[model samples]
Target: MKSIDVLLAVLANGWVVSAVLWKDSISRNTTDILRKRYRDEKTQKFSTVFNSRKPSLTSNPASKPFYITLPLDHFTTSNTDTFQSRYYVQDSYYQPGGPVIFHDIGESSIERYAPGLVDEEEFTVSMAKRFNGLLILFEHRFYGESAPLTEVSRALGDASKEGLTAFFKYLTIEQALEDVVVFANNFTYDFQSYPSQKLTPEYTPWVYVGVSYSGARGAWLAKRNPGLFKATLASSAPVELKVDFWEYFVAIEANLAASGNTNCSADLAAAAAWLSQAWETQNETLVDKLIDTVYQADWENYISQFRNQDDPRIWDTRRDYMQDAAWTAFADFQYYGVQGGTLGKFCDIMETAYSDNAPAEGLFATESLDRAVAGYTKAVAAINPYSYSRSARNKAKLKQKRQSSKLDSSLDDYAWLWQVCSEFGAFQVANTSRPQNMLPSFINVAAQIDQCIGTFGESDQVSLAGPNVSPINQKYLGWNIELSNTLWTNGEFDPWRALSIDSTTEDAPTNDTSTTEIPQCGTTFPRGTQLRYVIVDGYHGSEFSEDVVENADDIGLNPTNTIGGISASRRVTLTSTGTGTPVADARNAQSLWFNAMSTWLPCGTQVFTFTSPQPSSSTPFKTRSSYSTDGPSTDGSTTEGLTTDGSTTSNPSRQSSSPSENKTQSAASLVLPPLMNLFMLSLFAFLTGVGFIL
Candidate 1:
């Protein structure tokens, strides 16, 4: 019995020891797997991770990719002897092992608070996916999270009035460019602390992308740091240094006209004309009614179309309108038939128009409208060249025609009555006889009203009026010359900026007579600048359709095959054949573009190509071809083609002596599987371990 008991105890002890050893082994193995996936280093410190220098180019492939966001110190100068600036850092993210990095800047504060609008975050994600690169989003100083510490400086004394403007003047393009460089340099090193991977700065190239205001910044950055960034994708950016308020007004008018509201346009124009005549005659009662009618009608017919009051679009439009109006009104209120107490009365009317139906009949009823008006007025007054009265007079003459006619009599008369009451109370304070003090404000307001009415008051009018004076021409000059050397982008449809319409030709416009040109792949501009233009089917930056959004991975990973379509092999075959003539070649310029871009961009080689017959041309010219990386190509094609007839040739065959030999050595000819394999391995491991966990 004693011997048997001993044997049982020995077996139990051995099992216990084995279990303890097995648990420890499993724990270590799990930790090892995680470590391999993350590339984590147990001993690395946080500070060392954050501020590490860029990795050397030849790091191991198994290393985990680094990712980070940090602040960068940027500087800007002031007009005064004092150097006033702030420390602003761009928010950046770096994907491990990806060849490209992206940088984005935020919009102005006015753009952000506007009510019915979509933010840029969704768009940014979409673009990041499309480009398959790291994204860096930067905040403009004096806006959003980047407000300057000098707010107190503005609050000290009367200088506060000009403080914000002065501060903004210091936040110039040059300083913004410096911030981009610093961010790029730091992005390489910040990834060092990750346990599973190694990131060396030398392995990845950077691509800068911007939208709206940031688009301009992206373009300028690309120009400034050609070595740092491989390419730039700028969307809806307005980079012109000088902008006219009239352009915005005109855009609104054109938009209204395009909506096919003939009756509304006519009525609005008539009402404006009546007001102008009334102001000239000093018909205070008539003028007051006219002003009220104008506000209500404009809001109902035009402004309401922007968005619901709660909508971001509505908020943005209202904010813009108020800002523009206040600047124009305060600069010269009399131009809008406002004087003396009229300014205060106008504020009251504006408040009522914007406010909800409430018990106390709130003064400036709409808090949003009131705040917008006040803020805009303050901003405009600070920057305005002329004083109030002077601006008003200039506005009255220009807008007289538009203010005269009333649209809906009931709404017009009701608004007119309200205006009369306000004016009656305000007219008592009118010191119209004392023109000197009031004239400046009046003139400024008038100039703004004139701007709204599609007329230029004396102070607001340009002395030299011609093609040179046109806003489009002016913007082009600034973009092509002063702002060109910097990385920047201008939009084709943006009211404040203009892109070249002459994209078909290579020659940049010399004078007013020259046509503006679009940029394409293989299209080189003077001074080694390359231009690329993308034409989307819908409104600018339209989201992908539901089908596309749902099937992105399938489309990206395994595209469907079509027998008659252009494929990788077919494209190669076309290049190999070398049968098309120069004109036939000129017509196939788009195909050549696909071929060229495939050579230049690492991402481009992965894109699938489809060729459709050109609709505008006969025989061989009749076929139009289009290429897309995202999915199957849309069937129809537009008339845009690559041309050699201009300053440059579109046909690679004509441009190069030995086309067949060149095609063989072209970047497109290289096998894509090796790079794709690396991408897949990294992607699979990343998706499995990271939150994707698929």
Candidate 2:
């Protein structure tokens, strides 16, 4: 495979953009972007299953897939044209009038992983079980089995001028958001050929939750359509659309230097400086020890073919860049952490090698130099364990290309690369002026722009310019997102945190300066909808992980507080600094989020009030068991004499025999039209009335 292909494969395999730069060094625990399969503790693989919604009478029911038909173009004259998009549902814990949690699938394949979101020990599942709610996962358009085009050949076969343009015309972030709104509305009330869900008296409440890129979508979706989506839990979401995102590397280096080893960081920095000097001096022996000269020669030869082409995608450089490997190592350490299988051991080797050599007169003695070289080799091996295997694969692919005369293509890579080029240009480049800069100076924004253009093989067709990202920033308000009823939670160690809405920064103001207070480490702003931020001491997707409550010996902070873990890391809480609200405890985010959901959509309370009289044939519906005159009571129970308007009322003249029978009568009392379907039909009708129909 070409170097570009390898980079794109890494992008497709995970949601984090850094994954493309440091593939084998990082784990797949971040976001489920381009992953093929995931394995649990038992080694049980969760792979994608490609089956239609309906199986014939002889086929198994478990293999069935669900689909939603959406318009080809929702905003234009061709909006009447539609395509079937796939989705998955897990309703085992679904209650008739409980809350609904929708997990947004990012820019990758969504299959059996859909069910696992609610079936496993994830927080979504726990929330579902807590509220007896329904869970649904929808596939993004052009990803997984939800292809807009019928044939793979038509979608990704041709990369030539016209072919690339035609392939990505309809695949925009706006269209995907529209698709989500359509899915959310439709899934709440009806499913074709399955039991139709009743949305009556107490309409089920909906909550949107997502991590990483999807996390950004979740916040925006709720912000865009507030009434439809009641609340949002956008974990580790990057709200800003950046161009030269050098701050990302700044955060990465900070995290690495703080990785429990001060000496290791110093040695790594020294080594990077040394490599740069060697590259400039053209020290053959030193350069060969650092980078493979043969590989560099091959790269130069391959890249030279397209240099003179007037295409912006083709790079013009001929120099062999060093320290990219070191940058990758530092990135892996910051992203995955030492516990998540990163380069701590390799850093140890480096530290040992550095101490033994000591760099006398800016050069090492023969024995110590060999030891340091050996250490460097071990470290590179850890970073790119499959280096040999990858070379073999590339050679085989080249031979196959020579015979068949075709390049290996992937629509997944193309799709994501387009998004990066068009919207979030968060290209991680080195900020060399900073004191702690470790990445090589050549790995800058210009290089990333070239890569973006090169990957798509388009100059004018794709924008490496500013026009594409400006409108989005203007529309969404960038990091100063003014959406209410939205929550932003991020892990302290997540490098993407630099680009997100961090309350502590001068860039992300709370608008109320006196009230805006940044917490030390494990604290959150008082729980209100006025754009609050919480920074937890965890890795990516930490807020969404299940919190395990376990007894522990007090480590001197709070003896009775006990301890909890979100996977390997300990869970911490955010203190409530605002007046009248007490400090939160026990899985701070989970507790705060759970309380917010209950406040947003309480079970024992009626959200909507009705004035029309019930039909004569309608049975007496049972009232909720508990109610609070002031609001939600401390105890999770219902009271008698509760009315729709949240006021106390006398008992009904007639009452059902039991709660179960009353529930049945309540479900039967009033009829509800499928609002989502009706809305879609009305949309078409309005378009026809306006003479915009095809």
Candidate 3:
């Protein structure tokens, strides 16, 4: 009865039962599971759009580039109130690959990247090729093609009855970041939807790299959207979260000392003293001459008067040297050397008062000496407001006026003296001013100087303005803190707006251990988060040495490929490893040091090192690394194998047969015994089934 019922059910539902049973068997099959897993693995391997494409080289690639323009603080109702932002992209060379994009972050001044200065297009191309990605360059919100929105709004009376005050408050750093993100999203989507030349199939990962001011923006974007950018590189950045004027003044002072200007220091002091005294005497003619001198002093004359004072023949030598184009070039090179960070020897040459080996040239020529005296006299006279006051001649009134004028003059002299000292590096500027003032000034000046010097010369300068300019601290408070953090926290080589003061006392600890102690008055110390500091003994922005560049290659970075390679003579190292043979088994440690040094060694002579457990008789291995050339010492080794080469040390306990032995065994196992047995079993089962069927 049961067999008859089963047969009837199978005959009626054969197709349905077969379909359901087959589907269930397929779902449970190992082959099917393996196939699904393989597909998932493939997808994961190509997850990043950037890695999806194949490498190719083409002189004239057939692809049209797409561009996006963003408006920051654009006023809808007024033409004057609009600011511009721009970004560019190109499709990937590989099909179904991600697109590449580049962004150019603008610096602070309106005159930045002008016709005579650094070529923007060249810079863009170099950076694009260096990163092996698409490029995007945009003017800052208030500069260049971008409009000064606040100024424009005020001019157009965009604000309500609240007047210009309300309209003037339109620009801020956060708004700048928002503008960048918006432009990026819109541009990336547009490229993905309708590529310029159909080279790239979809949007790809983005990378942002910036120098000086724009470095601040790149850092801001990276920190704000870590997931967005695969990586970010910022150079010569000043990333102080808060503004402090005194901090900047302090930096200037430090720069002055760094300049290696011996005569300038003493001269500046004397000039200040002279002005203060003259102000008390109400000297008018001297004040006017001093102002005129500031405008007329050429680079050579200035250097001679300040740094090369002891050399009686220095001015003549410079004049003679400048007569020949080759000599002029040599002088320019020397000047750049001083500016770059080669101040020790340069200062020695100029230190006539301290050294017996003085050059024949006097610090200043006769004409220059005359000019300086006149300028000093003029500056002194200008301090006296009463010098211009001819009507009040009463004895008592005259005395009171003279005293007041003297005090004002003295203050002005002090200010100018501090500026000169900071400019030439007589003392650390941070030690001269209060931190509140120091911070903002440091941020503004440091940012400006780095941008200008990095691209142009100290001779070329630019101006910045806004209603919020004064009390710079208040104005900078509006800047994005994220940008600040990104700038300061990344590399010690990079400078931020934070005030950095030198220790006044020799006994003062190097580390910032006094967490709760507020810096003293007139000290330009940084507050808030303590910065990780590394002092490199070389010129600012000097190229790293070839050896350092070679070392960098070990760490997977080629600084030469990125920045025109370093000069062969420059010595740059990450550690304090002096030139010598190892005292013990330091070979591996040295190799590790070489790898670690490459990561952050700027284009110059550099050495790097790491700290590890010293080798002992019991351990017999000193697992450490260290190196140094022309810069500060660094640590780049870890306990878990060497992080430099992306490899781990083998465990001492684990032992395995060599590849040859394993291969011999694997080859022998490729015999027919297992196959023969399986075949015989299958054949017997098949015969038994046949017999049953018969």
Candidate 4:
């Protein structure tokens, strides 16, 4: 599934990159599940057939890109510097007085496929149409053409430290969020081609929607600037920022075992143990054997060339680099979960594709670890998971990435890395704390910091102490936060779930509502009441890929592609009215999302009315068939905590009334309607799709 997804992405990108481009494809950005998973590095060769099929960004003039000048620093008066930040408007479904639904293209270039995201059938686009609102996709600062300092190279070893610092100094979540508000304050659009639903918070209502990191921003924005946004729908928002973040492996290990990709978790664990032993003990003979077995490269010759060329191992040169390379198959799980688990493809090979040298059976003088290594070696050789080979182009590109000092994205990476080095201390280190860990024990936060310091001028300053995630968490209130008029969702099997409200590995514990904790979050939501949901078997941002449910077979989804051979995509096709199917559960959740929004959104009339609809304490699945609401009212404030605020309660227990649904109103299940054609065309554009391949 990983390779196929990669192939589709590569095909969608319309350019066959030199084989080495995959190195650039693996992003070590803040949101590991979104960026490297869906979109990757760009090239102009290797693949030309698919390029012809890609839709042009100009195909829809209504969604054509737009830009506005934004101050480099909104929090400080340090400089009056400004940059042109790019945005796109898909107002086909918008009315003159409708609300504007802003989608933050968080940390990626919207210039790719974002400008073409005008299709009425898109999940976000569909929401805009449903609410008669304008859909705006705003690119985050320091990404795409939104960079404040363009000509300034952002390379880690930037020639001018001032240039590197100056370029990234202004990029903070606070500043980016401010950019949205600032843009809205003086917002104007001349859609001679289309009527602008242009108005500020004083006269118009605004809504925020995003997935992954952008989703976190939605939650934060709703909390900080309600005057600017009335409602927020955050999907897979990892509000908690932890430096260790070993729970990442916890979720991955748990999910792999649960979904019937049997032996995958255990096999990888054994492999990690052996890899750690061989690398750390300086077992040269074993290292050579493993390298020859896994990568099929001549270890001695490769080493000679590596020394001569001074190539940068994409992850790090310190430990066995393949330790990082081993999991590329699984990193894109969220990206492929809509189709099926990305691990599904890799596991099939792991379970079946044995290389010639792989042992036919357990042999004498060998422990079980030997068989595990053989299996892994065979799997890696068969999968060619990294797209890395000892070709001249591959080695050359590796050297090129290291020697190049431009931070402005020769491959467009350093921007996100800056954020990771800034406030998002989500270092995906090995969980040595756990009794059973899946990653090589050698990978630690210190190594990460060393690289950051070695590359950029400074680390997050955490050395061995790990990053002080408190800076972002304390400010945002982490999972301790509660927002009225906001909806939160997560994928049950997503590795990122470890970082979300559904987390259970200690850092922060939740006394859930299904059991009776008061406000149910993450696990369950009451109809017409609570706004949190955990999609059973769902992956990161799976909500946006709703179209996959309708076209499962058309796109070659097999029934056995998911857990225990249960096609995950098939679960989305189960009737949309019940909790039995993954799709059904998600749609039903979205139904509540609609019901809540209908009552919350005061565009014109009361669509569905609801009372102070408090969900039962804990993760209880209570259902209410009917609801009623009074029309939305305005306090008439022009700034912070705007009119039509739907936030009903906070954790500290703020008293705000919520609406009730007259009936269980479900959002219309999505239909592709030629949308996939456009979706694939712009598939290369969701720049930051999943998280780090590292």
Candidate 5:
């Protein structure tokens, strides 16, 4: 995807100005964007990547898919049936008994990681090949092609709330983790060799790496199944769970202010305040007008085209339309960071609303608050507003999209929301107690309750309880979390940091300056000195996309690719001190991980390439590419033996085939998957040309 920074100035009197040379990447971006689905297709085409015991590959092995039968219900036999979970293996680098590096792809398609398998620049591939490690992309159940239950889970025309009930029952944190454990127990990889290596963690050193929801899964799975994985690197994992997470907007507001654009945030607050005032008063005409202005002149018809049916909520959208409108610009910032175009573009629109006449004073100054409302509207018009909802229409669209086959979606909404509704109560609410809330005050626990009832058949009451998020915490000690040989990481600007070990920590985090404090991998017993990292000026999924361009001017490039290439080439700047920048820390984290992996397992170079690789400047990609018709199956074979039982096995001694002297290697390297319905509008962004999709 092509990207060029534009800096055109806008004057008052409601007019326009000239700008920079524009390059049309939308066609190319769309082409590149659409091609991403090939990863899944290619993955399924070559069902088994492992050809033979003596097979050899001079070049890096392309990632290929394998399916293993996992119990649909790990907890009980009520649904004793089984479903196939997909995993991709890139084992060309795997030497005899070398460590296994598992990059968890939770709530994402296998296609999203197609590059990580072969691209040496990616830490997953580079480090794995260096250490002669077997790199495996482990797909979490119910996401991407790993989705189970053809008829009701997601894209088989039966994804209604009633239809998805059975499927949702199988999509649980424990069940997903158990899938990993069972895979481990049954792992029969002839890892780059003859006899079945039975590459169980007992026989090999397995490293767990994941970001966002996968990050949380990595942490929780590590805890549940100890021996399955030796070292864990959970980036942007939200360990804490809660309802009414008003603090989410706190990060956005702080980030906007920190970016030296206090007025942008102020304007945002003003817009929210304006809309909230109208919403509170129930001014139908103004509300409708405000929404129409934000959407389009033909907003009603525009919305109706893609709608599943004649949704009653279109005009009187349930779950606080005002709140949804205010959050439209910001729904993705948490996932893509401050640089995600929508949020920044929204701010720009808000600023230019009256900036020409009265530099900083306009909206909220006038009697009507027209400028504030207009700014909000124009911003959404310029940039796609994240108006994803679990309303019946979206459900019908997902259920029936198979008819057109334009796109097939993972039941991300249903699966993730199930966890949130049942146990993980992380409702994105507003902190209304504050004098000026960046997010509209319309969002609160009650609003979330309406959402829960509206989506699932649950009428969970509004409880402004402690971000106690205790249900999962009680099962696993929330921030009071600890694991053996684990590396915990979070992005500084990641909104989910509020729930990760980064924000809710029982122990002080690992100081960046004092990384050496992390003990040598094997010396410590039951557990090692765990490492906690905070990516300076980083956002969700920072580690996964470390290749993004970084410099004195650009500290971060909000990648839309990770979330499906929708956000666009929004950029952020920070004074870079060669030592602690986003890219720098990302690499540093990788360095630390490599060192720890070496200490824990037998591998090629005791150290690895610290030489910097060329950075990638692709447009922001937000989620996975489109899914193929072939998702995780109820009938499939398993070479990976992918499971997460975590049960211990007799230790098998392993030796590094290409062992080398321990040398010091230089450091390098979701964010959590946001629990928002915002991702649902990615298609809208792609087709509308309002925002860059790829």
Candidate 6:
């Protein structure tokens, strides 16, 4: 049954695009999932309906891209003084007195795709409309077209080299944060001198939004400069960076176990044990022999089959860097969980193949195992988010030099790897002590350290296992750091969630002032920084994706995808109520996010509304749903309605009191159309047909 679900999801969704883009893959930032996924599925064309509502800033008449001059070395005045940094502004929602939302682009290329926070009519845009706020998207310093160095002659060498090392020094997260600040200062209030004269030149409240790595930046921005950002909405931000991230596998195993697939878990564990034993032997020949024998294929050929590049093994040691590819495949499935348990599907296959009484043609069979391994390898290889290949890095560099580039996206993979090697040691290594360990011991902390040494030279200050890691922890406040008005969220199943702060974590910065204890998922932590764990079944960044209703086939989702541990903040599809209110189904993440947004920026009417009529009050107040209100149903649907003030409205209010004298009853409620019911029903049917029933 699990295998069937997996097949259906893969067939329906084509591939886990976001998982391939941002999740654990070979070379984390190598692929740009957004571009590749869209190319395969939606082609280069975006949703025309969506494009009409929130056009790209570059395409909009009221919007334009701007390049601001920034210091190459922000700290040293003697160094090269300036480099051009890129940013975009959309003034369609700008109101002289309104707020602004600053969207932080992640480590990927932003200009390659159109930008909008929430979908066509979702929460972010809805809030923009409600507050009449301006929306701005800023590309990080080294990503997209924001290139400090136009060309690089060398791929690997000393820091004094005029290529990678010289350019990478300016690509720090702190510099990127400053780039946004400079852009904000120039655009937000410097109106007379700025490109957009239509916008006001006054201080306005600003909100920050980011996902994954950028999400952590947003929180850090709010933390370090609280007055700059009014509030931040961060989804799946691993603010705490750890060097030896064995907990990554721990999360994977726990999530797999949550699926209730005992046999699947057992088989996968057996495979892990076998692989670990091979690594423990420390014999390259023995390891290669075991791999070829078990899977009935040569390790080098199978690993290189996808990328078409030679094996990633270092010439100095026979250790195959591509050995992590199989583990990555399993890890991605657990992290993605797109159609509810992608990992479960892989496990089911393993269980079948490793069964004691398996047939001759099964995975254990010499001939069949070879075929199965090769097929799986090919599928895993196709998971790239970026258009170019690792083999094309040099080609891209040479091409950049030959052309007048508006935006050099070739720096993405190189820049991201530099960040990981320099600061954030988020290496996904194995913890063999765990009972459910699935990754080989060779993919250990030392291997990753060696990788950094190979990429960034031996003299590089990147030894987290050695004496150099303490400064990074001290500078970032490690896991114990605290900040106010920032929400830190992580998916319960996300392998990266292990690095994030949670209830059981004891590494929180000692300087944290908040008294709130981080709670397990589905609970509230009101004392300190806002922390949310999406425990109700989701993969990495699932909360950040737009919550729109689509056909099961379109999204590779089935009705059964909602089955998992229940949490207060879980999203589930509810049965339609025949009424055309378009409020039957709602996303718990969106609901919670909007609710938090209202609290942070409370100057306007709440973004959404849902409430029961006052108990026969003498002053009859009009009961009208707000523009963003999509109330939960009383018929036991999964949708949770929002109150007038952005509070979760699950059950209708039973408060017994007279209506407030200040409240005005809506005229629409007082004089209803004769065919109101029919009109609503028709509207609902129309919305359902057009896939807008969120």
Model 1 regions more than 4 Å off: 1-95, 99-103, 109-121, 130-132, 151-169, 188-203, 243-245, 249-258, 278-282, 290-694
Instruction: Compose the digit string of candidate 6's lDDT tens values, residues 466-561.
Output: 112233344556466565545566566666665555523444343333321322223334444453535455555654433333331121112123
Compose the digit string of candidate 2's lDDT tens values, residues 1-694: 3654543233322212222322211212233321111113262211221211221123221244466677656556534666667666556666666677787767655553553543334566666766667676666776654555433323242244346545555666677777776665555445344476654323567778777778788877655655555567777787776654556545445555565655545555555655555544544465454444323443344345553434332222112224335553543333344433234555654555545643432222323555655556556544432221222223222332232101122334456656665555565555544545555554544444445544454433344341144445555666767554455676666667766676244355555421212221223345432434454445556545433232221222221222222323543544532211121222555544554554455423223332222222110112222212233221212234433234553321111110001111011122221122222232222111111101
Q: Model 2 Cα displacement at 341 (Å)?
A: 3.6
lDDT, model 2, position 570: 42
Instruction: Report the C-alpha displacement of residue 167, candidate 1, in angstroms.
Output: 4.1
Residue-wise lDDT of candidate 1 within 1-694, one digit each (tens)?
Answer: 4543443333322222221111111111111110101111262100100111122224322122122232222331221122211121111233444434353534322111111011222333333444444444344433322333343222211122133223333333444455556545644333453444332223354555555445555655544544455455454444433211122223223433453433323322333333333334444443323222323443344333433434333332232222223333232111111212123323333333434332142322224433533432332222231323222222222222232111111111111111111110111111122211111112221222222112111111111110011222232343453322122222222222332221212233443222113233343345534333322111122111000122222222111211122233432111211111111111122222222222234432122121221222110111111111122111112122222122221110000000001111011222211111222232222111111110
Clashes of each: 97, 8, 84, 47, 41, 10
lDDT of 3 by residue, 279-334 (tens): 33444355434433322233233333344344433322222111111111111111
Give per-model CA RMSD: 29.8, 19.6, 35.4, 16.3, 17.6, 20.8
Candidate no. 5 TM-score: 0.67
- Report lDDT (CA) for all predictions: 0.27, 0.46, 0.27, 0.49, 0.49, 0.44
What is the Cα-based lDDT of residue 436 in candidate 1?
15
The alpha-carbon deviation from the true structure for residue 206 of candidate 4, after best TM-score superposition, in angstroms, is 1.1
Residue ranges of candidate 4 with Cα displaced over 4 Å: 1-63, 154-162, 193-197, 292-302, 306-320, 337-339, 353-371, 386-407, 459-466, 512-530, 548-584, 603-694
lDDT of 4 at 280: 56
Better of 3 and 6 by TM-score: 6
Clashing pairs in 6: 31-385, 31-386, 32-385, 32-386, 33-385, 145-407, 480-508, 480-509, 481-509, 622-665
TM-scores for all predictions: 0.39, 0.63, 0.39, 0.67, 0.67, 0.62
lDDT score, candidate 2: 0.46
Give the residue spans of candidate 2 off by over 4 A: 1-62, 79-81, 150-158, 188-195, 199-202, 271-285, 293-324, 330-335, 354-374, 386-409, 457-461, 503-506, 510-535, 545-586, 603-694
